[model samples]
Target chain A: MLVLTEGLVELNVEAKDAEDAIRKAGQLLVNEGLAEARYIDAMVKGFQDIGPYIVVAPNIAFPHARPEAGVIEKGVSIIRLSEPVKFGHPTNDPITLVCALCGVDSKSHIEMLQALATLLRDEDKLKTIMNPEASKQDVLAII
Target chain B: MKIVTVCGMGFGTSLMLLLEIQSIAKGHGFEVNGEAVDLGSAKGMSCDLMVASSEISSELVDEPVEVISINNLLDRNEIEQKVMPAIQKLSKKG
Candidate 1:
């Protein structure tokens, strides 16, 4: 079943940097009772400890920690930026979309990741969602 | 054949890529043994192929493993296009 809801969708969000974007996206998972505050902290730290390699696609990023980080439940949340923020990806930069994924184990994360990846393939859908005019139905169409 | 998916940390995107590689490999009429590894560990692990994003993939150019670097890690079409021909070559050899 899909964990993303109208509640988990945030359109035209403001974030100062990649760390802010990661925290904001992770917080949405926490708000929905799927993750903890510590998970959010770990996410920002994960990027800092590792690098900006999480920017999986052009203008898109999936900010997440391991299943053991603080996943209360399996879930996905999204934040569409009002203004693009750089995640320091070498090529795919100025990210406008951030998705946070939390899963209890590797098994569950695969299905969710597949779904997210499918959505990302549609550049038109992503562009539509990035618009300030997008509605709950619009974002839900893909998520 | 064995394939490894790599990321900064193994538990997240790399594992996701491993699952996709497994599924895609099946479609190509071959069974692949898959593992997920961090970029640091992937350098030492022996694998038929290493799939990762452009940034991580570029860093491992000097490694002996064949690299399938994708501009968009989530795009299966891109993944298949870049990876299958190489895997086909390996399959023929095996």
Candidate 2:
């Protein structure tokens, strides 16, 4: 299972755009040696190539790259932006939460995503995570 | 039944979709084998249904299976609303 420790969560971050938001989220993973710097670029490129489907829900964007890009470990970095930014999606745009995922392989990949999918589906839990005053412990407790 | 979830890289968004698809399938009392595949590999793969974002599903129009395009992947209600009907249609055809 992918344990989302307090180190992986950042609250009320500031970003210039969607790319900046993703980069900041991925940086948390890189800082913990979970992924390399190139993984961040790969995630940004994924958005450019694949579009804003990564914005999986209203005010939330899940950015990730292929494992081959540069995943040193399996983990996730959660960033709650101070302000929302547009990701160009038809419905789910202006993302406030950016969840950057780094998977070492397929099995663990699905495992991690399953956990997150469940967390994202809960409206109340999502409300807490998106709250600006939410501490890292508060966020980790729910995830 | 088999379902394939398609996305650009396969491991990220598509895998998320596959998990929800499997859960929804189970809730509806359907046993399904789910796989997540990249856009490149999904074309040659065979399955009863294909689930993906609207952008990726548009590219899969030529595939043999029923393609269900969803607006939001994490929203189970949207996925169930869109995918269940297609699954029912597929079962009837089979």
| Each candidate's DockQ | 0.67, 0.58
In candidate 2, list every pair of residues with a backbone clash.
none
Candidate 1 stretches with Cα past 4 Å from truth are: none
Candidate no. 1 TM-score: 0.91
> Model 1: per-residue lDDT, tens digit, A1-143?
56678779898889999999999999898888899899999889989988887788888998878887899989899899999999888888999999888878877876777778777777787777777798768888866
Q: In model 2, which regions exceed 4 Å deviation?
A: B44-46, B62-65
lDDT of 2 by residue, A1-143 (tens): 55887779989899999999999999999999999999999999988887776777778888988788999999988999898988887777788999998889977777778778788888899889988888888888887
Evaluate all candidate structures by whole-model CA lDDT and list the values in order: 0.85, 0.85
B2-93: candidate 1 lDDT, tens digit per residue: 89888988877887777777888789887888889898888878888888878788878987879888778877888888888888999898
TM-score of 2: 0.89
